[model samples]
Target: MEDSNGSGRGPTVQDVAARAGVSISAVSRAFTPGASISKKTKERVFDAANALGYTPNLVARSLATHRSGIVGLVMGDIRNPYYPEVVDALSRRLATHGFRTMLTTVWGDITVDDVAPSLVQSRVDGAIIASIADADRLGELLYKNGAAVMLFNRSAATSDKLSSVRCENVEGGRSVANYLLDKGFSRLAYIAGVEHIYTTQEREAGFVGRLMERGVQLFAREHGDYTYKGGFDAALRLATADTRPEAIFCANDITAIGAIDGVRAAGLRVPEDISIVGFDDIELASWPPYGLTTVRQDKAALIESCVDVLVEQIRSGQRTRHIQLVPVSIVERTSVR
Candidate 1:
């Protein structure tokens, strides 16, 4: 019940090591999974630890090994349902690999700079950034702080120093354009997310670029900022215009659902009056009310790639850059004619 120093304090690693007839480092290795130690030594350490009721201090062990066994997950705008699903899958995957998740949300007035210091101070072995306005700055900061950086659902265009896992956004956009054009819709409109973000730019470029190649022009364009209210407002604007588009392609599913409501509120029938399409086939997209046709990104593949890249960097102490682009597919539903 007492430490090696015999000051009446609870048992410490020193007490366990002394009783086990081993060095302090040996005791640490016994507790660390995958550490190099023989079974007999580990059994002795466990028996001594049990007799003395000693438990290794994780914080102290982290200081010695320089591994916090934690991964920071920086997300943006949890209001969108897509991110919650990403969080769930990513957390479970990381747990299976013996690492815990430390979450931080950057939305509204909150910026990455505001949260980066805490994540760095916690000594996270690595970080996975789901969304960020300034990826370059955040990647640099985390990299300098000794944390391997991985961008989830983001491209490495802005920050080549970090690894990334994302879907083929440009191709997804092209597929949407092809679907709408194949339906014989001459007048097509587009709803965009943030103007400067890579995802938005790539999706818009692919959609409009394909349309131009087909000798057609975009009838209208609006910024939805990847939010429900933004989508609603943009749709209302398009609905009341002197000339309305026969079809609308939203950058994401949340926006598409909002656009559908706006179209209905404006007394127009979906598919019958104006066909709609969306990207990122979120769970809500398949609902009877929405039935949104969109591009489906493989969430499982993306999370697996992110975890693999980050864990390798942490274990190897090497900063090897990896940029993975998972394929995307079009999901047809009642929203599209």
Candidate 2:
């Protein structure tokens, strides 16, 4: 073996030991977190490591610890304000528990197989998928590969097969529907997110089902993809219909803002010509430009629970499967009467 300098030797633990004036075990301990070594010895070892440009190999660490100390975070549709907040919270909380986050955004025709395969290649200790509605099949691959897996804001249809943390989307939708109807919104419309998302489907089902029971017909239903443009376009369609709805329930705050603009462009005053209610009370929802009335998902508690479950699975070498439902509450603001 040849070193980078063409010396007739490859760098070894002995080389680091000699340079640091320490035993080989001391050098190893310095590089390994939670391993015991004197501070002075650790500093010397690190300095030698820097001089040699030698990166600690995690493969060896994994062999010794039976852990990778890395967490894969799979998120979709980052354009939605709600997701970024979720990602931030998840990453921060995971870091506190000594786990690093590997972020992957599945967008623009990306498949489930593509995402899990890539993360597996990187040898992430475990994975937390935040928004894959069709995650049942993907869960199989990760489990087979011995990767601890957890779902966030999404659930597997296969009972007790996967772990997940999500909000009470149905309750939120029902609350919004009842609130709007009680405000005397006789005619209502729904601006739904992607039809395939489990959370969106549940919210839509609850909102529309509750309204129908009250004999309040939904004048229109359109898909928003949880985006501003999708909501804007859907808004125009809802407003142009004969005998338009008196209020609109958007799937998320970003869409709600766009819907408000779309309604105003068509010469309608919010809550006068139409009232608007949205889910996912993102930060921007309370901004001056759009004081949107929305449903708040408990971001902190959701993220904490997700990280805790993932760590348990990772450390125990087994799945700690549980279904956690975080509560959601409505935030009333100027967008609705």
lDDT (CA) per prediction? 0.88, 0.82
Best by lDDT: 1
RMSD of 1: 3.5
- The residue ranges of model 2 lying beyond 4 angstroms of the native Cα positions read 1-55
Per-residue accuracy of model 2 over 115-205 as CA lDDT, tens digit each: 8778777777788886665576676677778888888887887746678888999989889989998987777889988877788889998
Q: lDDT of model 2 at residue 23? A: 95
TM-score of 1: 0.88
Candidate 2: residue pairs that collide: 271-274
- Give the per-residue lDDT of model 1 (tens digit) for 1-337: 5555578898888788999999988998887744789989999999999888787788877988878888999888888899999999999988866688999998889997899889988998999987678776787789999899999888766566888989999999999888889889999999999786788888999999999999999999999999998888898889879899999999999999999998988998898988889989899999999899889999889989899888888888899889889999999999877
CA-only RMSD, every prediction:
3.5, 3.9
